[model samples]
Target: MSTVLQLVKRFREVLLDGVWIANTNFKDQLKDVTWKQAVIKAGSLNTIALLTFHIDYYIAGLIRVFEGGDLEIRDRYSFDLPPVESQEQWESLVNKLMSDAERFAVLLEQMPDTKMNEPFVAEKYGTYLRNIDGMIEHWYYHLGQITLIKKLLSSDLI
Candidate 1:
């Protein structure tokens, strides 16, 4: 495979693997705690559930933008975070996230290698590759936050 294709494959693997493991770890920790406990304020902002939604939100938005679609997250603070009231709600969001990621993954894989290095203009970010590089960094950063939050939430359970 070409370098871009290989990079795309590696990117897909990173996304899928991180989501799979993080979701599993979070859900497992969540099982022993009530919604209130899960949403307990560990700090000023971002509950475990909110962090999870934030994770999916950015990944989906970035992938959509990379696919030459209109920007998804126009206003960073425009959206409300998901409420951690029930496991069912959390599970629903998680499922939607997985579905979104899978769709984006397929789209990325179908893209021509030449497209990866091509320039696309964005209002906020000038070039496409720059945005994609930022996307990868952003996703992994949130993955770290999710892992930390899961551990914090897991404390009460254990």
Candidate 2:
């Protein structure tokens, strides 16, 4: 398999389907989560909805760059999720995340193996491979949090 294809597989594994790392992907974790459950505050941890939005923020921003646009995302604004008050709203966010994730994978798969070593947007941001790997790691970190938060929300202790 090509390096780019391998990256796409890993990307999809975290966001959409393969479960080699967490035993759960974003699609599976967020599938049955209701708006209320997603917004439930489990201590100081971020809500599942917020984490979903946060990850999608980066994905969407990267998509723009992948499509030949500027990298306009900022860390401070990543968590600025509007609100998830209804099932429709929550589902919309999830749908967007899923679509963006697939789009990201598709864009990535189109890249040449040599492109992986090229700087992402700027030299400061490191190579395409680094950013992609960081994204996967970032998603897994939040995936663990979402999993724990779900467990806490389900337990009577929370």
Predictions in order: lDDT: 0.61, 0.93
Candidate 1, residues 1-158, lDDT tens digits: the string is: 86455555555544655354334333334345455655677766467567667767766776777677776575474246745677677667667666776776677677676766666554456555566666666666665665676677668743
* lDDT top scorer: 2
TM-score (all chains, Cα) for each model:
0.72, 0.98
Evaluated at residue 96, the lDDT of candidate 2 is: 97
Clash pairs, candidate 2, are none
Q: Model 1 — TM-score against the truth?
A: 0.72
**Candidate 2 on 50-83: residue-level lDDT in tens?**
9999999999999999999999999999999997
Error of model 2, residue 152, in angstroms: 0.7
TM-score of 2: 0.98
Model 1, residue pairs in steric clash? none
